[model samples]
Target: MAETDAAPSIALPPRQTDGWQMLAAIERVLEAERDQLALWVPVGFGAGIAGWFALPGPTGWIGLGIAAAGVGLAALLFGGTSRLGRAVTIFALAMLLGLVAIWTKADWVAAPRIDRPKVVALTGIVEAAEPRPATATIRLLIAPDTGNGLPPRVRINVDAEDLPAPPPAGSRVAVRARLLPPAPPMVPGGYDFARVAWFERIGATGRALDPPVIVAPDGGSSLADIRTRLTAHIEASIKDAGEGGIAASFVTGDQGGIPEDDNEALRRAGLAHLLSVSGLHVTAVVGAVMLLTIRLLALSRRLALHAPLPLIAAGAGALAGIGYTLLTGSEVPTVRSCIAALLVLGGIALGREAITLRLVAAGALIVLVFWPEALAGPSFQLSFAAIAALVAFHEHPKVAAFAARRDEGIVLGGARILLMLLASGVVIEAALSPIALFHFHKAGLYGAAANIVAIPLTTFVVMPAEAIALALDLVGLGAPIWWLVGKALGLLLWIAHVVADAPGSVANLPSMPRGAFALMATGGLWIVLWRTRLRRWGVVPLAMGAIWSLLTPPPDILVTGDGRHVAVRDGRDGIAILRDRAGDYVRDVLGEASGVEGEAPALELMPFARCSADLCAVDVSGGGRTIRLLATRSRDFVDIRAMTRACAAADIVVSDRRLPRTCHPRWLKADAPFLRSTGGLAIRIGSGEVESVAEQVGLHPWGSFAAGSR
Candidate 1:
């Protein structure tokens, strides 16, 4: 309406809004990120090609053909496709190749791995255990018992009979058993336990149920004896400090002295990861070392304010981290942490301002290329996912806005530390949740709360105190350090107990299928690695897969029996009965185990009654009644019969154990405790687990595994 409304020329500014800039920034990152798919393609081809020969039987030929097809397809795409087309094609093919390799490898599983059950002569060192009478796991280096070439080392799950007195980690022992590679679970999508054990250089695993017939012939001079002596010395020093055994475990991953109840409490609380001696622990050391090194550098004028000094400190931190990894015996988690750390350090050295997702992919590729079996391992999956998330997408401006607003202290120094920890936890825990749910079926709600205090305390106090105590012991000033160490240990134990006992402490979820987990993981990768927002939204596919499982249609082939009993019913809560403890494993395939992956299942451990009522809140199935029991138990205890009949009026009778002579009910003893239904995979949600605690009891028998104990 004014003078020039129609004719005024409007100035068109450049389309460079903050959002555009961010999009552009993302594009630049995509461009700068070297084509990891290109790399992954070649690596996959090689593994498939070479492994073709190493792999057993006809599947190798099938794999070879797939490799050829992939190569041909890759070439055609390279010759004619656009940049986007080629990148997408390469990624697709590489992923497909990886999937094929996974399935093919599963086919390669073999039985009768160890030569025979025997009492053979062997020599090796015990890799670890707290020195106290309560807990320890000893590894023995195995040889022909008379060979010049190095002998393969094996880890033996030792027990009370292995030694007159319990030994610390690294004690050399001579013992024997029927040694064989542990068998992976026979069920589809179950954990590949044996293969993982193999990667850690263990050829055979068996119980050290009986002690060596004789002590070392040359006690002081033998290498095994020497290691034992050194380990014992450390043990004595720790004992002298008068700290209870829990501290010993935190620092050493040896749970020899912790009471079983305390261990159980910690496991329930989700605070058990503190004792694992993995990345978290290494990071604590790194934090302390970095602080010390930076302070030292600051004292020297030449070092102060120099970017090079910071770089050097990072490098030094890497070395220290590696040393710890070695001392900790190169556990899978530690190895992954060390590898990831160095790669990050290298990026820093190269003057890189950003960490690309490709770096994470590259690191994972390197580890997998060498240890392909690790693809199935928990550490490998969890570590890489967490690292990938942290390295690339952990803190986006969008996600971090809330965080910034919450920080009222001007990003003060302490606040910065807290922020770093919280962010790291969110990234890593989110990345691990699906897998954890798939595996153990429970989530640790209190993990963050526990770690908030645990991380800082370990970083500033516990770790440093440990180092000081160790250093002092080398001289003669260990007593005071011991007292401090004891206090720290007590703090950790108390934290474990408190966290474990929290209400809503352990919610159970269901176990998800492996395929579903892989889909979710791929979705995360797509989200992080793809530059285009629309493409990244491919996470919707994974999310959909997860949700689909939550609404999994109930199964049709319901086996409500152990070996002895069989009852078929519509898949619903309180459906099956197991007789023998061994039967639980089998039952799990057909039904839910003790719930807690995501949406808790209703499976219970056997040899008890009133199971279904305890597992579910509402009976989805109409009330129908079935009761099965062993005659002996029925006659001996009227309570047993009453309890069986009261399985919330379940309409099934499957007896896997010996059927009651009068009841004549068919039952199965094997039950599935490893799975969940109607949702996600059940993970070992809390810190420590019953299995870990049970294993520890062999070394430290102070606690109870008494009958009917939880």
Candidate 2:
């Protein structure tokens, strides 16, 4: 009887193959995630924006044609009534919508950018002014008298000594300045400041050659004036530059006055987000307003009974959030937070689950729809990622149940809340690490631990104290409160310095490849968005991406497009530069990109390097091979025979002056002409590979704007 039963089971389908089993498993996951489809629409839309940005050249009508064809195909396929067909149709429409939206935005904001440095006399009204210790930056609304060739707006930096006092906004000023286009990426796959400047309508940036003379001073009130006044009041009140600067930042979102050392400490400690007005600050402001309004209303029992107190409070909160966003300069992070807060308020008013992933998705969609360029920026990425991670984690069935459980005592409940906060910090850090590394080449390893102490302090103690003090200042009764605010900020700064000084506080990583970053992002989204156990499969791609990043090696040689600055790997832990006079910005960029942590190694001091008046020779070893590099140090003339011989003997040659045709190196020649075309070069000697900033940038409109030579 057993044999007969086994024979019948075997004949009943011969058991499914591994492939079939896998398909069935995927089907089950799809079934489990049927309700989660809306979350993916934004994902597809973002992918479309990314794809449009990745094109090597302008597609013009070609992209539109392809999108049209895709939609038509989707329509035909969707007629079959299969789930796969329906999903495809939805994805196509979503992506096409994204493409159209971004295209329209880019075209709308396409303003002419300066392509070369020009010393021009600028006379315009000061749109905004940001004062610092050594310099003041003023964004100008260029007057029509400047000629049609100039941008509508320009930003110029003036030495503090040049200005007795920074010109106030709406004051007309005239000055001679050496203006140039906004800078491009310093290296391949680095940050693109030009794209950002383009969107902001800043066509040129420069330093003042002559002190700006005030042509007309207007007595008027504006948001910029209010912000400046507030900053000055806070700074004057606190007295301590660092603490006051931090306080001002918390209040007005102006961080220009913060000391460099303190700013670096905060960044290293992973608390720099405090200086940026984001969700944490916005929520505090809105919550305080709501609480105040509710209490005030509830005091009147007759009105409270008929008022719908919660809805009224929500409206007040929304208004406060909007006002704060505008006051804080409407930066990307603040804008995102305000939008999210408003959506949450709407959800609350409607009596729905207010803090769900759907709320986050809606907020993201709104931002992307209006500001598609923000999709590529760190502000948008980090803000959305942090909130999405928090929502997804707490929304877990187990986590929700645990959080819902009533504690037996106050201490137990407090302990539970702290434990959850710690866990949440860990998850947020993990989710954001890949993105941070991609943009900054490093991630704060101890940020989660530091945030545990810093977040509460900033949210409850520091912000409230500052707000109260600022309010009391108008009545001349804020000294005590300002003192308290300073004390709180002092403690917060101490925490930042302590955490930053901790060993292994920051993970200094090599530049991650774009593909690896994409893969990790996809895996992270998969894990965070799905509810089924099958989401564990995302770990495969996550692991693969991390391994790829760790395995990828830093370049052996880095040369600026002007060929005036060159850097080479010194040892396992250091970098060597060609000239001792290299600027701090250049040194920092090269060191960071080469995976060197901490203070940059002194330039032109490597044991394996030798320099003369006109030339530098460096020997770098990696992957069991040594590369000989020759670079020019100055414009001093050299004998052609000697130069040709030296160049021919080397593996790579770099020079600001064009090299002779006879001076062909074994590997690469990055002379003036080649460098002009390439922008910047990163070479891997062992792999015989080269990457250029220009090649990576492709033919984007922003790439044509010349910051300087490159």
Candidate 3:
């Protein structure tokens, strides 16, 4: 009989009590995996801060400091063989210190205001277009030229000099700009200009001193002008292609041409990423090249051996990808994504059929080294997280089943492709959700569904049309292709618009508290760095969610005015007030936990979410259900009783005048509840009656509309 090899002796610790065993297991992890896991974290942390570092000022210093600390921590953790325990403790301590510094530095917000009276000539590049078309402003990328630092760099925005039309891209010009903060209440419902601009490293904004002048090089080359022309051409090409066309967008990051309505539809359908060229776009181009190269080389073995067809194709495709990134202004996400793809391609060229985490790590190290400040931008954070998640997920057994088995055919049917896209979207969305929610207060719930439908269409139809359009334009026959692209774009736009308008579309979530957000982010990082395994530790976020739910309190006071209803903070927290009267919008700010059983709960649980008193005419009764109310003819009772269905009591008793009415509730007595002041009207509460609180403050309405029956 052939001798059978017995299973290798299992290295087993003697059986012990559950508690001791658990502690031993954890200790083993601390000894074995903790140091390694901690080492990778700095890279993740560094990537997140890279873009911000490039912005100049204390931000750069903070980034540098974090990086230094991280490296030191990694060194201590991984350097010596005998000091592992000490190394782990030191690394943890360093992380705590570094995070505090990073967090404090990021909270340093600048208030940028223009000084038209002291206008000075400045130079910079156009970051993006202002919503208004009257003119555009250029944000300088130099540090001395901006809000902080004295090294001849800064991000000052100069209004474009008045010209017949916009200057072509890359034209360097001098302009006098009086930097100013965006006027308060800048947009109807949008981002805070100052905060967002802060992240972009822009300090002040003003106007051009002269018509943008073209600056020439020592010899005569004005590469900026050439770049300008190309950018404009790309923009126009996409615009001409109609709405939602990714072809022109792929060449330039000007997907705004896709129309917001159409974009929303596509977003709802889960296909909006097609609008931006990212890892998927680079991969698509690479896949196409690989397919073509394999087919072409199969015809002749000599070509493969003598010409090295695979290498040539990979090189060409990579060059194309890099060129694409450059043509599109080399956005942080695209650049990072391109670098990663190239690393993978470079691996392919090396004759290794398998690519590894080492490749991704190399790519990240390269990017962080180059743009240390990029880590501040959402793009870099989300992009890197998505990439890491995909890599980890791909390495897992179940997730691999979802990944493309062969380069030749990932999936065929549109629905199947859609599902894969959805899965990827969900993975990324889930990975980035906490931060996105914390910072943006917006969540794309159906994003996965949207990507499912959109990515395939984009890969197969939209992206190819753009490449074809470019060639056609070169050959002087681009109009037909442009037209075809435009038509398809319109369809995608329509789809996007429809989706955006769907019953449950944009989830305008409430702002996340700092601590909770920190917890969520930490949990997510744990999941991302957890080596493709669903460890029991993954339940940390769910535990947090449960805690958040249990701890959340009800709103303190419900105030209504000018057809508006808002929940006032009743705890030790800073208030982030919404713009207006949409109860749904206000409800979103209170957060989703408030909304239970398809309606906000009427619980007086936690101290934070609780409200003070039933106040205002908007709705104290029936949970202020409907959002409709006619403009106040007078501040007297506005009759929303039918809507509130709070047969017990009305939303609030309104009184425009100081006089009392027998019809008004005895508690509501002709109270002067609304008073006009410089900051605006003060709607007081905490009275036995809704309008009574204002009466106690001696604020009387100057009219006779105070009666509930007015």
Better of 1 and 2 by lDDT: 2
Off by over 4 Å in 2: 1-28, 59-72, 75-80, 134-148, 216-219, 705-710
State the lDDT of candidate 1 residue by residue for 50-121, as single tens digits.
Answer: 343234344555666566567647656653344444554565465445545654554454222343344455
What is the clash tally of candidate 2? Answer: 0
Ranking by lDDT: 2, 1, 3
Ranking by TM-score: 2, 1, 3
Stretches of candidate 3 off by over 4 Å are 1-23, 27-39, 43-165, 168-178, 181-201, 207-227, 234-246, 256-258, 263-272, 289-301, 353-358, 401-422, 531-534, 545-710
Count of backbone clashes for each model? Answer: 69, 0, 61
Q: In model 2, which residue pairs have backbone atoms overlapping below 3 Å? A: none
Compare candidates 2 and 3 on lDDT and give the better one: 2
lDDT of each: 0.51, 0.81, 0.49
Best-matching candidate per TM-score? 2
Q: RMSD of candidate 3 to the true fold?
A: 12.6
lDDT (10s digit) by residue, model 3, range 237-345 = 6554345234456656655344444544554454555666778887777777676777787688788668877778788778877876776667777887788778887
User: Any idea what lDDT model 2 has?
Assistant: 0.81
Give TM per candidate: 0.66, 0.93, 0.62
Cα lDDT for residue 514, candidate 3:
40
Name the best candidate (by lDDT): 2
Candidate 2 per-residue lDDT, tens place, 13-36, comes to: 578999768756765667778877
For model 2, give the RMSD to the true fold. 4.4
